[model samples]
Target chain A: MSFLPQLAFVLILGVAGYILSKRIKFLRRNIFLGKAETRNDHTDDRWKTMALVAFGQQKMFKRIIPALLHLLIYVGFVVINLEVLEFILDGILGTHRLFAPFLGGVYTAAMNMFEFLAVAVLFSCVVFLTRRYVTKVERFQKPEMKGWPALDATLILVIEIILMIAVLTMNATDQILAERGADHYLALGPLFFSGLIRPLFEGMSLEALHFIERFAWWFHIVGILAFAVYVTYSKHLHIFLAFPNTWYSNLKPKGEMVNMPEVTNEVNMMLGIPTEAASNPSAEIGRFGAKDINDLSWINVMNAYSCTECGRCTSECPANLTGKKLSPRKIMMDVRDRAEEVGKSIDAGGPGLEDGKSLLGDYITKEELNACTSCNACVEACPVNIDPLSIILQMRRYVAMEESGTPAQWNAMFQNMETSFSPWKFSPSDRFNWAEKVKEEEM
Target chain B: MSENYKVPTMAEMAGKGETPEVLFWVGCAGSFDERYKAVTQAFVKILNKVGVSFAVLGPEEACTGDPARRAGNEFLFQMQAVANIQVMNGYEVKKVVTACPHCFNTIKNEYPALGGNYEVIHHSQFLQQLINEGKVTLKGGGEFKGKKITFHDSCYLGRANNVYEAPREVIKALDVELVEMKRCKTKGLCCGAGGAQMFKEPEPGKKDINVERTEEALATGATTIAVGCPFCLTMMTDGVKNKEREADVKVYDLAEMIAKDMGI
Candidate 1:
């Protein structure tokens, strides 16, 4: 297994994989380097989350076809890991099948399973591409989607399809060699192609085929490793990130806002939105709300990176669906882009680490925040449980509390909330007046 | 037919804690909005029928302070909370109940921090129990068949307080056919009325959310939109009316529907 060529290949992949993984982790960690939104007991719902999120994909099914495609790809992605291993083992271990002994005899079953999955996933990826490029889901139509990530995804898809087909060919060759007593224990779809190779084997047989198989074996092994390394850096990072994210999602009610600091006392505790906490975050003495990514909690940052970009949240968002200024996906992405800017600044020691402008500035326009009805449909439909409502409410609180800035009607409502104890400014004395009019049997 | 319901102000009691058989906090919507009168009357009627001797402190009950607090007027919300606690101490009211979901949330979830703690129950919950216990009966009325209807689950009563079944139970008890909206129960849509938005103009959505909701109900072809909260009833009624389907659809509070079925 320590052959010079194989070692060199693995070493290349290992280092490249390590670098990209660390860089993304670094970017994700620093985006919002504050506290988490209350840790939860994962052990309690781990199985439930797995059942619902991993297998059931209950959230994804909100949109039928895409959900089905995603499920197939997810399962295929998991099952195909075996093929990659089979390639490596056949190339380096000098065998066409896994040699775990007891596990070896089942290679026919196992290889067929992997091959079947590869076909399914390939088809799934096709449907996914159509959904993304042809159908062009609204979640992916953000102004930014025309940029790098979309291009990267298209390139990756091409590579995956080509790589999988090549490996499938190599699998066919393995079947031919194995049937001729060349030692591969697999024979399923591999058998059909292997049967074709039988004619060549009929006259001058195993030795020539072994040499051909050896070279094909090396190409398949290296190709897989290269793709594996590329995924760590590409848009495919969510492939690794989604599981951990699903585990740590905010576990509270969608309408229930987080408990914030009591900037002013005696006004009782501010329940829903803050009306007067911090004003100008750009100010030197400012204790203002989040103007950018820096002020958000670590979990909020995670929510951004944790985004699978599957677009489920944006698809379910009533605002986005109705032509509003809010695409929950875009809002999170903008926050993330700003954080990446800050990360670059930190690396260069510049004036970029969340300066004066608040989160209410252009990034999350007031129109977008106001557009939400706090209905939480997006939250319910999110595969990773990102609560877009919480972010919207925070912006609402910052605007309401510190700035006291909003439309005239909202201002009036605030005034009424102070006087009427209800937003309508109804006189408290007439509170029971409604009861006087009810004829006891009006129903 | 008429009684006083006052929310206790802290100054009235000055000091000392008192607990009564039950605290009658008349929620602002129940108190000031005459449109919600049937809900209040039905609740009172049901309470009496169940032999739960409840008293109304007409002026003693203050606002539960949910709106004020949610609207960035926390100071006012606090003052109201303190005053209610003081009044409750004076009346010796230990248990609290109200027809309004807003009042239920403020009293049960928000009051403990300000020393205004008591066992609180929404009237929908209480009345549902009464109906279940056979204390409240429908008389001189048979099962009147109507078009299918959907129930609008209020945020507070449904998700916040986990009181999803009671209102639906009341609706099911009626012989009218029922259909469900795409979003119901935990995933129910808000009427653009919670979080003090009731007093303010909505945030200018492309589609008026209530209308969107009413249309969703209309899509189900339900003749009536049954609701438990006064705000939901008011907003949805206005929403249905604005869609020019006012005659086609009517929003009825759970109490009004229940009281109608029973010849009280």
Candidate 2:
């Protein structure tokens, strides 16, 4: 009967691991739905970017208050995992404080550190909840964050708070049990925060205290495992994706848009320049730009998934600030939503990519694409280097080339450019007309 | 201006088997936009005064296809790019300098993929280099000494190419107090003219981006607002006009300020 608890623990671990691996496979398949593009150059730069931007949380410092608050939670999350490692081992072996006797004093010191971080994490989570609810930070209150996005953020914070409480309660009860000379409850020195809460449990029967301690331990471990699975479906995926996303970040000057080599080949043929052996003469020409999620590069799709819905991109977007439809945050969210929709359909063997919906028209609108100034503010503002502007431009290409849907003014400018080599219909021969003013001033 | 201040053309120079130190790519706005023509003239005067051999591409120069690319017409953009590359390569042009950030960015960054590569420099960076070389000198803070000026960063020149310091350096050389807007450098606001927005009316918005940006510049309380890119020159000039502060607040390109300071 004692081994039944170990069997249950093993079953739980097996189930959680299976679900997590399945979800990871789903994520990988969905991200690879995008077109292939090489992002593996500049190995040294990629590592440094991943280290500084993702690991160091460098860009978060752009806003000091949040950066400090976030750092506490981030450090706590990393440090407390060590305590979790002991919890896992104890649960699997049906032993208490598995590392306590092995390391002696070091175990007590580490417990104290974890306890302090737990309090810090608890405190930061409350402040974050307050920012999202009470004070209502502007970025978190955008139209794109109205429903699930807002709830997801709140849920994660609340979950962390409960998990921290569970940790402290378990520690406080275990301390009481140890003082009462109970078996399996080691008397590791007092943990500062948890010790303060030990008084409430002092009067309980040893059996009741043991029940609460075991319940809290199970609650904490199970909560952590559930969180690991839940993170894949939430914006909290940034905890993992930020590393790979930043590693493959665009390294060229911000102004340099990716060149379309296919367009280059076509233009070369039209200009009668000896082109590299033409793509099979009978092969069908591909669509000019992204009409659906798959038309974008894999990195762009990954960027969509990696977004943490922070709304930093939207807040910094000039188009959004000026009341245009182009919220870059919304663009990323739309891509991710469409990707999820198509990915699920493919999983169900439903008509995928032919479901009469597309990323351009159904998810994101032409108004949003048109409103972008191609300014890199949104790109600069993203903490993980998500390039919504690239997606915007690609969709704009679809509208212009596939549907001939550019605004009337742009088409006029295009005609002028073709006829006179300028956006205005001034003669090319008079290109140096401004120099006449120089001569006139000289006279 | 002296009669000796004649702008040479690449065609004429090439006919004589001569190559200038740099090819001055006078962009569409610098050629046709009436307000921006003054900027072109001022930069030319500075280049002439410095004795830098520079020639314009004249009729051979076409649009750099930046607008088409940003507007999402890749075919049109590459068509224009191929035509321009053929002409420049034909002339063996090696270096290019431009006063328009759009042209500078497109030629410097985008052209290499299409077989057109040249050492491209924005006029702001080029002017800064000239000042550092002592080829251009300010005489006792020539007309606007100790006056308050704010340098507006062009999105393409500053954020796009990371050339924030050069224009500011040139402005400080005028001995003017360079006050900065709340948004400057990497955080600089766009002038509502990039991405071919200059050719079309802005989408429905509560206010124009230029007005918002101009409000920030005016809040700095700088009397003179100096800019480097021609698109910025036109947008900010109109913005000052929109606020009806044209008389009290003047928007001048960096080259115009330097030319006035040198008495050229």
Candidate 3:
């Protein structure tokens, strides 16, 4: 009978791992679907950034209430998972409290800590749910968050609450078993948080308590596995991606934009400046800028995947604050959604399915993209260093170069810049007139 | 020409086989806009008073194409950038200073990638260094003393290049009260002239960003609204006009303010 339970646990673990790995693999491939560009400079800076931003949750601390609550759940998630190792071993060996003998009295201390975290996790989840549903935070209620985004956030919090409850109930039942001195039940001290709830089953028979304990164990482990699989598809992917995303963040000065080498080379050639031959001789002169996911840099796609949909970027955006349609959070979400659609189509059709729709027009309107001031506020506000401005600039480049659809006034400015080498209509020769005038004024 | 008032060009200086200490990049507004021309003259007067050997690029100077690049016309931007680069390189120019944040930003940050590298400094920063070095001294109690002066942070200067202190430091040197707008420094709002918006009409909105920013300045009860960039000077001045507070509030660049205080 013990052998059967162990075998079943092993089988379930196998299936969950397989499904989770498959989803991870799909996500990895989808992110790399964009064109390759290097963001690998400043290795030392990247490491420091990852440590500060992701591990330290430095940016999240800007809002203290949410930060403390998030830290509680985050610390609980990380530290409590260490206990999962013991659970895994106990499942495989058909034993209860397998680490108890090895740990001596420390086992009780460890269990106490885990129990505390479980309670904290449960508390944080409830507060998060209240903030989402009851408080109805403005960032969480934007139009882009109406459907799956809203449901996804609620579901994750619910899952966390359920998992925490299972942990507490399991401990409570195990304590009852230990008191009864039942077979395979070690008589350990009562856990701090769980001990309080242990009296609920005061009059239950040993057999009934044993059944309840077993059910609690199964529910906790199964729910965790399901959550593991579900999180790969949710914005909670930030739990894993945040580390890498923060590590690969742009480390240069915020004002400096990424220059397209192809455009640079073309300009160098046009100016009759002798340029080196093209690196990829076979590569044709392609469209000037990004029209879809594949045209964007891999880092941009990674940014999409790493989005927590927090809307902090949107809230901080001056354009969005001023009632423009350009929400930086929605820009990231649309990219992720488009990437998912393209990834799914490719998976279904052997990587050759042509989706006629694109990120522009069908999803993000030109008005939304044009409304951006390139202010770098979004980039600054992202808890994970996602550069929404880069994506905005790329799409604007497409509108300008491929579609020739810039506003008429902007086009006029461009024409003046080309002819007179200035945005003004005057000749370059007239530029010095102000200097002489300044001299004449001084005289 | 009077040695005290003459502004030499790169071509004139180069003809004498002499390179000035810095190249004064008189930007489009400082070179053309009538109001900004007074700002340019004030800055020039200060430079001359300080005996700094700075030469203007004059006709050789072209727009840095910051407006073009920001407007998503990369081709035009590059063409303009390359043309200016060629002129600067031909002049064998080294250090450059500009009173315009837009030009300062594009050259200091963007020009490097296109093979135009120089020790570029905004005029406010240069003026701060001059004051620190005691090159220019204020004539005591010159007009601005005991006046309520509030500084507007230019988007390119304050947020883009991290140049908040230099201008404020310059203002504080006049021994005048330097008040801050509610949204000053890093959290400063754009004066709405950035990103080529100065060259084009603003998109339809409930209120202009400059107007909103100007209201913040007005609420400070400042007699003088100090600025560092010519763009911010124009926008804030226009904002004051819109509120009919032009007589009550005057917008002056940091350079212009110092020149006035120096009795230039």
Candidate 4:
């Protein structure tokens, strides 16, 4: 096949994919992390985190052996993709068969290597499917998927299964045909598929099987590329987007609490947990932080995108598991669903967050935010390293600093800390009593 | 080369004429809040046994503002931080030691951001050094040979500052049979007492975090539970008592355990 036509198809599709991504408005905001110290920025210590977390997928399989199965499937898919080009070139121009005519042995050897890789990938996907269904790792086992998203995941699995099987069948046919010819010592086609098609082709002569080869070649090449485009817009976009997201992670401060904007007009500002972001939209209008999804800083929204939906954050969250209102899964899904629902409006590119339905107003609650232990287990579990602690801290700051709305326990703790310089409600002057013990020891 | 050790907090020096080589900054929990005050004082007692003289920074010492900062009140944290810095600068003290892991981590990692630069050491590390230097005798804890004991890694001490070995070394030196909780080091579960949750009541749950951990210790069939942080000891003891599992496990601070064996 001449390089011109396939190259043209690639460029056209690439542009369409790029433009459609924008039109669909799926990706929003780059460098979308907060201006804080995150581990990603401190790459000097952990260069491997980039590879392991970003590529090796340390986050996907929380469980060891099952995760390994998932890893094999993940790696297999990535490794075999390079072969699609050769299949395309062979199909369009009929210039290359299983091997190059000019350099028969070398070309045939390369095909043999790639053919084996394809087989491995096929086996991997089958095991991964089995793991997803049978001995399912709960994190990957999402039964709650509804509407198009649910269907999309299934379609993806089906496509991969079909591609792998077709490649195997085609390669089998090639191996059988190779046995007939001396130059065919290298190509292993005329494979398992050849026998099935053989009787039919034999009735029409080997010429018909040659015709069958042309169809298989075309089918594998075009089908994979279209699938690639489909993935760009699909939930599976993490296959590509996750790496870049992890690289540019927030790398925010480990313990620095988010500062709430202080209130100067103490009297006019609502006194207790200003649950709403009073919107007078004027330049100096006082509002609670994060009125809506768009109101969330670019990094927070990026967190929603950066999520692999691994469920690590949600699964470990004490609030969610204990049957509380919050689930990091629900939180992220809420953002994703809300974003897709309001895409065109956002694409209109008017004021962001100023207009959309408020995120906190609709989904989150004071109890849910307060229930967080700030334990950072969710942060630790996240493969991409998004920090739920930071978000909770921000909301906490809004409640304490701006609204001064805290439960009586917090009120009492503060009173104790203020008087005694400690929160234990103990005598302040006794702060140094331990020193007497140290002195007695010396004597 | 790093000169990363804590400088004496101002509260340590009052009318004291000269700078001291080490300023022991006993945290509130170590001083007035818990009986574990002996951890720092007895540690100094041991240091004196090794002929290492240290100054105590008592009255001038105040909260490290960890509670306020963690509870999301930045203004209160800054206020306490400013006051603590002033007390430290007044002393011209050089080195600081604190028994509390919370104070150690906040002083070592966070204080510099607000301009409180100090060289800080946890007494556990300092005491271990004293032992290594042959400054103090390890005459402590009558051989706890038959009793299996579990060690709880304090969050701030182990994960925050990466000081995993000192307390464990102390336990090993006692010749006690050591049993480790499933989650001992970095992966150790929080005692449900961090983020200033200690002073504040916990959200209602079926069981307290401390009791949950105490049950973990009892499951190991350990007769005693040892802890480095005073907060952990207090909470875990309460947890054991609450579960009525105190008969199975007695919680002790590494300091009290060592002092008993040292015959101090």
Candidate 5:
């Protein structure tokens, strides 16, 4: 009968692991759906970026209050998970507090530390919940955050609170069971926070106490497993993706937009410049710019998945502040949504990219793309270096190059640039007319 | 203006088998915009005062293709880029200085792939360098002294290229009180002229971006709104006009301020 519980624990873990791996594979496939672009140069610099931006959470300090609150949760999330290893071993072996007898005083100290972090996580989650629901922080209340995004954020916080409660409940009951000399419950020193809550379980029967301890332990571990699987589907994926995303961040000057080598080759041909000796005459030409998820670079798609919906990009956007239709946060969310849609359809053996819908027209509108000033404010504001402007520029390229659908004013400017080498119709011969004014001042 | 303040062309110098130390890339705005022409002249005046050998491209110069590239017309952008590269490479042009952030950014960062590479410096950074070298001397408490001035960060120069301190340093050299906008440096608001927005009307919005940015600048209570790019010069100038604060609040580029401070 004891073996039956171990078997059940093993089975549950196996199922959770299987589901988590499947979801990870799905994400990898979807991310690779984008065109390949090299981001591996400067390996040393990439590592430093990952360390400072992702691991160190350096950019979060831009807003001091939230940075402090978020640091508590981030540190607590990492530190508390160290206790999960013991939980896993205990469940597999059908032993309670597996490390208590082996490590002696160290086990008590570790539990105390974990308990401290659990309380901190709980406190931070409550403050965050209030900030989201009560105060309604402006960034969290944007239009893109109205539906499932809002619900997902609330669900993560609520789930975290319940998990923290489960940890404390289990600790308190186990402490009571140990004091009562129950089997398999080691008498570790008091966990300060959970000790305060031991009064609730003090009057229970030994058997009942044991059962409640077992129940809370199972709930805490199982909830963690479920949460791990759920993160892949939520904006909470930033918990995992932020590292890789920052590692591959664009390192060039923010003013430098990506150049099109294909366009360079075409222009070279047009200008009668000698092509590279290795240039192939029969090379296939790809679409000019991003029209769908597949058209963007893999890093761009990963950027979409890595978005935490903080709405920092949108809040900082000049266009968004001026009441324009361009919300950079919405652009990222749309790309992620379209990616999910395409990934699921392909998984179900349905038509994928041929679904006759695209990220450009169906998900994001031309008006949104047109409203971007390409100012890089959104890029600067992203904590994880998400480049919504790059996606905006790519879609603009599709509208201009593929559809030739730039606005009338832009078309006029383009014509002027072509005919007179200026956005206006001024003659090149008169380029130095301003100098005449300087000479007249001299006279 | 001194008779020595002559803007020599690259062709004029190249015809005599001579090359200036730096090629002054007079961007389309600097060459044509009536308001920005003064900026071009002021920078020229400072360069002359510093005794820097600089030459303009004159009739041979073409657009740096920044607007077309930002507007998503890559074909046109590259055509212009290739044409300009051919002309510059023919002259063995090695160093370039420009007053426009857009042109500076495009030529410095984007042109290398198209076989055009030159040491490019924005006029703000160049001005700061001149000040550092003790070449461009400033009078104590010159025209801008005791008057409050706020330097607006052009997007291309500030966030794009991370040239935040140069313009501010140049302004500080005039012995003026430099007040910063609430949003300055990395967090500075755009003047709404980047990405070819200067060439087209903005999409329908509750307010124009420049007016919104100008409100922040005005809130600083600075009498002079200093700028670094010609696009910023036009946008902020119009913004001051929109608020009808033109008489009380004047917008000048960094070069113009230096020129005034030096009595050039």
Candidate 6:
């Protein structure tokens, strides 16, 4: 019987691991579908950024209430998972409380800590779910968040609450079995949170208690494995991506835009200066900017995947506030959706690059791309450092260069800039005409 | 205009075998916009009164290509930037000062990567330094003493560059009660003229961003609205005009207010 249980545990764990690995591989391939760029500079700053932004949740504290509750769940989720190691060991060895003898007092202490965290996690999830459903935070109710995004957030919270409950139930039953002097059970002091609910299992027979304990144990591990797999498909992927995302976040002055080396080289050649060695000399130059996901840089694609869909960017966007079609959060979501669509199509033996539609017309509209002010508000407001403006600018570049779809007035100004080196339709010699006017005013 | 106050150009200064302490970058708006020309003159008067040796690029100075770049015309932007950079490099220009946030941002942040490096200072920061160094003195605040003056932050100058306090300190020196709009500093709203919006008509919308921002300024009940950027000056002026508040509320650049306070 023990052998059969061990075999079942191995098979289940193996299947979950295999499926999760496959999903992760698919996601990795999808994110790397874009052009390559190096983001590995500034090693010390990257580590510090990852620590403070992702690990320490530094940016989340800008709004204090949500930050506190999030911190509770974050700490609970990370710390409680430490108990999973013992579960795996118990399953594989068919031994109960496998670490009890070795850890002694430490085992009880750890159990107490885990129980406390489990209760906190459960409490935090309930509050989070209530906030999403009842309070309807304005950021959560935007038009883009009306359907699956809303359901995804609620579902994650429910899963967390269920997992925490399972943990507490397992602890509660384990305490009852200890009291009954069940075989292979050790007497440890009552776990802090589980001790309170242990009375519900009072006067239960040893067989009944063991059965309940075994069910809860198996359910907790299985639920965790399932949650692990579900995370890759959910916005909660931020849990894993946030570190690298924040690490690779733009560190330059907010006003300093990324200059295209191709443009620089062309300018240098036109100016009769020796051009720098081009990265891909023979590559097509007509595609000035991104029209599809593959045209974007790898970091841009990674940004799409790392988005938490929290709508904080949209909430802070001036364009969105002033009734423009542009929503920075929506830009990220659309990119991820397009990438996923492409990934699935390729997996289904369809031509990947031959997809009829693109991220430009299919997902985001020209009206939305043109509406951005490039003010960096959305960039500043993003807790995870997603650069929606970068994507917007790239699409705008496509519109301007490839399609020649810029507004007519902008074209006139571009002509002015080309001729007089100013946005005004005047000669460069008249640039200092105002200085003479200043003298006239003084007279 | 005093003929005694000679504004030397880089070419004229070079012909005389001289290099001034700074190159005054008079941007397109400062050079052409009728109302903003006063701001340019006011800033020049302050520099003259302070006895700072500065030369203007005059006709040789091109636009910093900020608008072109923001409008996604990279080829035009690079061409303009390279032309200006070449001219500046020819004169061996070491330091530059501009009253325009657009120019300041481009020169200070964007120019170096393309190989044009200079110690670029905005007029507000430079004026504050002049005041601190006992070069420019206010005549007992003159018309500005105890006046409720509110400052409108240009997005480029404030959020983009993290320059929040320098302009405020310049205003505080005039002994005026500097009030703040609801969205000031890092959270300040755009003046509806950034990102090349000044050159084109606004998108179809129920309200203008500048009108909304100006309403916030009007709500503060400030008698004078001080701006640091010429783009903000134009937008806020239009905004005030739109609300028919022109008779009650007036907008002036910080340099204008300072020049007035100093009786320059």
Largest lDDT belongs to which candidate?
5
Q: Estimate, for each residue in A1-443, the C-alpha lDDT of model 3 and write its tens digit.
A: 65999999999999999999899899999999888877788889999999999999998987799899999999999998888888888888888889998887899898999999999999999998898889988888888899899999999999999889888888998888887788888877668898888888767998899888899899988888899999989999999999999999988667776666677777877888766744444267777777888888889999999998989888767667666677999999988988898999888884521577888888888788777776677887788889998888888888888899888888888887677766877787777777665565544
lDDT of each: 0.65, 0.90, 0.84, 0.62, 0.91, 0.86
Better model by lDDT: candidate 1 vs candidate 4 = 1
- Poorly placed runs, candidate 1 (over 4 Å): A1-4, A36-38, A41-56, A61-64, A82-102, A135-160, A177-238, A261-289, A355-358, A438-443, B1-25, B55-57, B60-95, B110-120, B139-146, B159-163
The weakest ten consecutive residues by lDDT in model 3 chain A span A274-283
| Better model by DockQ: candidate 3 vs candidate 4 | 3
Could you tell which candidate, 1 or 3, scores higher by TM-score?
3
Residue B50 of candidate 2: its Cα lDDT? 87
Give iRMSD, candidate 2.
1.5
DockQ comparisons of all candidates to the true complex: 0.30, 0.71, 0.54, 0.29, 0.73, 0.58
* Best of the two (2, 5) by lDDT: 5
Candidate 1 is scored at a TM of: 0.82
Write candidate 6's Cα lDDT for B222-255 as tens digits. 9899999999999999999999999989999999
TM-score for the B chain of model 6 = 0.97
Best by DockQ: 5
Model 4 lDDT per residue over A97-159, tens place: 633666566665555565565666666667766755687766564433456655676677778
TM-score of each: 0.82, 0.98, 0.94, 0.80, 0.98, 0.95
In order of TM-score, best first, we have 5, 2, 6, 3, 1, 4
lDDT of 4 by residue, B1-264 (tens): 322212232333344555667777777787776557656655655555455546666666778888777776766666666677666766665677777878887777776765568888877787677667766566544756556888888777775567779888877767788888876775566676776777666665455666666777778888888887778878888888887876756888776666666765
Ranking by lDDT: 5, 2, 6, 3, 1, 4
Q: Considering the two chains of model 3, state its CAPRI-style docking category.
A: medium
Model 5 chain A: worst 10 consecutive residues (lDDT sum)? A276-285
DockQ of predicted model 3: 0.54
Say which docking band candidate 2 falls in. Answer: medium
In model 3, what lDDT does residue A215 have?
93
Error of 5 at B10 (Å): 0.4
Q: What is the Å distance of residue A211 in model 1 from its true position?
A: 10
**Candidate 6: which pairs clash?**
A442-B1, A443-B1
Model 6 over residues A1-443: C-alpha lDDT tens digits?
66999999999999999999999999999999888889888889889988988899988886788889989989987888778888898888888889988998999999999988888888888988878889978889888998899989999999989888888888898887877788877888758888888888887888888988888899899999999999999888998898889999887778787888788888887888775544346566658888999989889989999998988788777677777788999999999998899999999999886889999999999888777888877887777888998898888888887888888889999988888777988887888877774555442
